[model samples]
Target: MDTVMKERDLAGKQREAESINFADLSPTSGFFFTSPFRSLSTEGCLTNVSEPAVDGDVINGKFQQAMQAAFSDARAAGIKHPVLCGAIPFDKRQPSALFVPKKTHWIERSAVMAAVQAQESELPAVLSKTELPEQQQFMQMVTDAVKAMNDGKLEKAVLSRLLEIKTRGAVERPALLNRIIDQNPNGYHFHVPLEQGALIGASPELLLRKNGNQFYSNPLAGSARRESCPQQDAEVSRVLLDSGKDLYEHQIVTEGMRQVLADRSRHLHIPATPELLSTPTLWHLSTPIDGDVLDPQENALSLACLLHPTPALCGSPTRIARDLIEQLEPFDRGLFGGIVGWCDDRGNGEWVVTIRCGTVNGDHVRLFAGAGIVPDSSPESEWRETGVKLNTMLRAFGLN
Candidate 1:
């Protein structure tokens, strides 16, 4: 037990209170935005911030080791319960949603979900589709990104795009809800709209979760969309597994997680090999990392601070990749790639990396999508891949 609690008995009582669950607060009709980036700041309202804790700076190997050291230090300090979770900051380089006040009449879920039906709408045309740079120019972007990789400047850079969606008549919140309900598998779909704030993504990455002295994080790095036809899907999965570029991307993420976990805990189990998973539209190579937390004085937010910006979302050799991004990309990511999760008094929380998401601001909505760049990654192909990522959120808006 961490020292935050006076004794093990006291720790039990505190953990009970901290574990209360709340109804999902996703708004019925208001505007909202969440960054893909998660931070201690995002833990507001979910956890009591008064406890003494240490935030792990996961910028380099040093910061990664610091997390493990902090955990052990907390246990030594006599803290009874410590929570650890992952948080990633928003990609400030891409177009994202900014939450604002809802000026329209507030409609209850009953009203919207009752007789109101979602109307058919057309997506805004890609005006001047030809306006985008030529293939060679776009290819230039890939060369530059690759050059950075060769220079050991980065392992991956999420180059994305901004797509616009428009709905006619009153926007149908229920329609969107119904669509998600119909499409969602395993009843895992959760609607977390930004309230007077905005968030980006229908993320599938579970960055971290904390319960007692134990902690968990699910890092998703490689991707391939599932196909309806079983045979075709099998073939697609096979292709993804066979892809050298995709495998390289997955390796970066898996290795990065292994390093971070080792830094925080002694005993860790990471599959020597990654498994393939098929989503509605893409496939991903996933590896689950689990360990006993070494530090109890710190909360889940602190853990998230260290684990975020992992190779899956960001890149390996993080600093160099980040620098190249600062030099090459032309957009601000905001929260599209940040983290979002909840925490409690005893320091228990669960957070996920924001991905497959978009930002909705009033009538105009700006969606974001990114593709991981690797040594064999093609710029033109990567660009198209991002379009696939964009569809995750776009489909949520009933735009497709």
Candidate 2:
């Protein structure tokens, strides 16, 4: 863990880290995590810590124990705050984590210029999916959700659908990640190696980022497709802002965040209204919530666990919406709607909702998207929204 690279070796190591396909660590034991928006990226792994707590309050205790272990390892290696990255599953009990000791060097964009200039390669010509739900089925499910909302069963339930894309050959993950980063320069771009494959995307929402005691969470709920024309896009944003349904959905998320963060933080700040946040394919109603963590020991991941399935991803009345999701959504969400990013031992890190992402396994990749269902939600419109959401990952595959 304390290995040092010579000057020449350092250059070579940096080059390897930048390579689109260069992953020094095994998916089963190690990982590569990055944030292109911050121009910070890291490869290789020094240690992998499993969250031991089964559930409830015990979980954070286990997480804290793991953090102590990682920090101890980092301290021995001369690192102050080692980075830990993994998918915090919607189901918290699942074992999912990758911790890299501070011994590893973090490469910045400036140091990886050669990797960026590397030639782009073509994805396999033929691609297929094991299964895709029929359009009618998804629409009907949405209809049922809307009915449930009107029936007072729940205020909102986010319904998600998965689309599997496969190629004849293994996917060039780094290439695909690079493409997404190129298109979505401002988005939170990430690539996390997994046992089965890897999770990659340009997420538009930030779940939590803790810098010492200060924390920030920007949640997005309401959305509209971004039009190609500037005037048309502005009109669309205006319409989204004016729409009662979208505003209501947006409010649910902001209020939910307030309720969750209020008890844990000394002072929490949330905007009176949501601002328009645009990705390459869609514009969303976004709210930025900032807080001062009362407990200095709480890291980014800890805050993320507290607000993992926000109303933006799940629904109002968290428990009720989660139950409904189980009844409605056919496939397991796995890491979708979960949290992903890096946390450090010094109670600092960034975690973002695992949205606009896909799981890549060999030649196959499964993409996911969800729409918030309110009483007035339109099945057709929700269906279209999922499609627009899928386009973020699809574009990386060179598809429309």
Candidate 3:
């Protein structure tokens, strides 16, 4: 028994060594996981007085300041091109996780490495059983969302459901978050630590970023999570792109983004069409709208702030979808569906739409997933869609 325990310990150490080596070797490294989500609210450039109005200029101003700070620091460090991405709140909603404990730097490294090591760990060993709704309940939710759309109640809305998970011991969850970081090297991976809250699975869709005179906004909409079979996955992607339901959802976001950029930008180019993007789990139809800004006044952070609760993440005809979301959804989305990213003075940064995410409220964690509802969308299918989205985060936790 001791030999087995020692062997496991040795393996954990080896994983730790590998993770630290990767971090040391990589030219680009910054904070990752939900912890950064909460920390930024209090400690980083995102910390600033918020505007009273939902759509106010205060956030914009603060965001600009944040860009300035990052840029100034980067210039000093001789880092020519620095990319920052993480979540920032739309409404100044502070994290629910009250006080996060400070870990020594080595412990922090361990936390990240431990998450990677646990990727292959058995979930049944860690997760407690929570009764998933019978298939009928999931179907009913779908039916209702679809009926609402038919009745003209929903132009588009992101309806999310919950899956309760129980864990043994102290609920060592961050270890799972780190493995997610291990798998994903393309974008910023963040986890916002909450006091008595949950975690999130976020791959941001909103990129209000700039390089020199080039400015771009990549708006993501319409998604179908990937499956095991490549052929089936390709079919799903094809269907999602061609589906009137999915296209309708994607178009609303594209149009809204174009309008925003046109009104603010100097020279705008509308791609004659929408393109598709793939993440580890799902396929997304993304539209990248670029324009030249003669003024060059808009900062990525503020622009992203204005675009928050977008139709892609929230819903369309903004106000109506928001109203319906509040009225029907059982839970307040908090930061789960909020934007989290960073920016520097050069207008260079990436901000992902907060989806497939959750927050930690102490030992208990709440995770979230949402799906866009259009006229042709089936509630059951949408529910399953969220399930696939949830896997992005759950897999991080080594749940799958």
Candidate 4:
């Protein structure tokens, strides 16, 4: 049996070697995954599979089964430690996962190494595909959310708006991805190709990162736009830390995460206070939570699935917030407010909240941003917060 296994592995490697055709592959046809502050980037796809989450399981048991099959195929192709990438919907159902084996090529660079790099060297000016939401409409949404909070219907709700941008021609996706990497080197930069479109972003919030039994999560909630002046920026951070309403809002997320993770964690460490984290465009109240999993079998994706759509994205009392989002928001949110990253068969992976992200399909791109609406939240201020968030991606397109 041992000899037979060795022979099979040798044959698989031979087949993989013969199948290499770097000249013909499109960037969208392959898989990619990278970690924040890491030099290594995984590329190419050895096998891929996806399925709808039709049952109680959030990760989609069917998808998990399909992943196992893909893993088997990958190993038969002489690949080990296959990695999966893609996004989960705001709704748990209809999640997608792509399994790329360890045999996938690794590139060490400030940018992803791919065929798309050869297509274009120039960046195009961004054009709006849809008008921004009218102030009255957005204000009304904020007012309604505040009313809901006052009426005890919900403690908090995250309301979002979409900004659709287009280009004269297909925006060179690889170029855009590289720009995001260059601009936000400290962020969780990702470029995941989907069946219909691709999800790209630089996320500052880490949903989950698992290494064996150890896990880490950094949830960012209350936010303030960064100021150009150093003094003003420091003042903004100070104000955010002192704001009673913002602190309450931040606590809702931190406490919620503690409750959910505590059961799975043997020794969970949650700070009594949230620290400030900054991106190029905004400053956020962030709490970093770490833990040791009670069960070693519990992997990254499973933990991410358990904590996704946190109060940071949905709101406090998740069920109520989700219902409000469906009724209040005009868009479906597809992959926005979801989680994206990759997990190996061993369950180690890094999944970041799909914030500060845009979906690209050819020349069209849709960007998304949301703000937590508490009782004291201002409609105008919430709208501006989203605008600040959108700037992170817009700047990558050369739009100020």
* Best by the TM-score measure: 2
Error of 1 at 144 (Å): 1.3
Q: Model 2 segments beyond 4 Å from truth? A: 1-39, 52-60, 73-80, 101-103, 109-119
Model 1 residue 302 CA deviation in Å:
1.2
User: After superposition, which runs of candidate 1 have C-alpha atoms over 4 Å from their true positions?
Assistant: 1-88, 91-139, 169-178, 186-197, 397-400
Worst 10 residues of 2 by lDDT: 1-10
Worst 10 residues of 4 by lDDT: 14-23
* Cα lDDT listed for each candidate: 0.53, 0.74, 0.56, 0.75
What clash pairs does model 2 have? none
Provide the clash count, candidate 2. 0
For each candidate, what TM-score against the reference? 0.69, 0.86, 0.71, 0.86
Arranged by lDDT, best first: 4, 2, 3, 1
RMSD (Cα, Å) for all candidates, in order, is: 9.6, 6.8, 9.8, 7.8
lDDT of 1: 0.53
| Model 2: residue 166 alpha-carbon error in angstroms | 1.7
Better of 3 and 4 by lDDT: 4
Instruction: List model 3 lDDT by residue over 133-210, tens digit each.
Output: 445665565566567677675677777666666565444444544455655533345554433433445464645545
Q: What TM-score quantifies how close candidate 2 is to the native fold?
A: 0.86
